[model samples]
Target: MFGGQVAEVLVNEVPEDVYLLDVREDDEWRTGHAPGAVHIPLGTLGERADEVPRDRRVYVICRSGGRSGQATMALNQAGWDAVNVAGGMQAWEHAAREMTADGEGEPRVL
Candidate 1:
């Protein structure tokens, strides 16, 4: 991986117990995201870092891989155990992983 840090994990490889952090924007998160994933828009991550669990693995994801990649690096620097969900929601959706909307209705990625 980069500079001895662990490489990002593909969506399929993420363990169920790891905390899933959805770093997309508000609307994006409301649209659809991994079931049980915590919503923390990337822009507010620094202020909400404490909301993230430091003791458990954190799998970070965004619409694509870009935002999550940045968030992953930040989380690591902040001493949180974080990994980018490679390919992000796009890949997760492609993999046919279960997803849920904010409330009810069809779950469609934005």
Candidate 2:
């Protein structure tokens, strides 16, 4: 998602306190992604809520903004800090950035 890139920029430009929380699936992750991102698929987030820290700023991302938006709302309702990565990875690609994918093959769109 775009937030991944924005967070990445902030991490470099405003490298004070920001974290990237990638909510993409495992196979999606195996493709390209931002550096220093923490892998935590959306399906497992609820069970792993405690694993996410509440002490710093957090930015959420997924293949598209929809899932991330859902996660953001859920986190916010649960009193955890989270924000949606607008445009998601598709948007990021539109910006002409590099994306990772499995070297073995490409993911088939259902």
Candidate 3:
């Protein structure tokens, strides 16, 4: 719902206890992604919700805002401290950050 070059600022400003959750598919993630993101596809979120850490806040992201927003709502309903990353990966790309792939076809901090 919002857009701007605040990825770095947001990432840096958040408390160290917060976590970044990437809901994009395996293929989409393998191309590149934000640093310090956890890969958890949206389709399997229900079953994998327990995998999310309850000890900290969560910022959700996907290819765009839509899926990330949906994931945020789901997490909120499930009692996790989750928020949508507003513009998702598109915004990160717009911000000119680099993305890297991992062995599991997921993105990792680079």
For model 3, the superposed segments whose C-alpha errors exceed 4 Å read 1-17, 103-110
RMSD (Cα, Å) of candidate 2? 5.9
Q: What TM-score should be assigned to candidate 3?
A: 0.76
Give the CA lDDT, 0 to 100, for residue 47 in model 3.
94
Candidate-wise lDDT, in order: 0.86, 0.64, 0.71
Question: How large is the C-alpha RMSD of every model relative to the true structure?
Answer: 2.2, 5.9, 5.4
* Each model's backbone clash number: 0, 5, 0
Q: Any runs in candidate 2 off by more than 4 Å, and if so which?
A: 1-17, 97-110
lDDT of 2: 0.64
Candidate 2's TM-score reads: 0.70
Per-residue lDDT of 17-76 in model 2, one digit per residue for the tens?
357677888877877555566779999999997888887756776776767777777777
- Candidate 3 clashes: the total is 0
User: Worst 10-residue stretch by lDDT in candidate 2?
Assistant: 5-14
Ranking by TM-score: 1, 3, 2
- In model 1, the worst 10-residue window by lDDT is 1-10
Considering TM-score, which of the candidate structures 1 and 2 is the better prediction for this target? 1
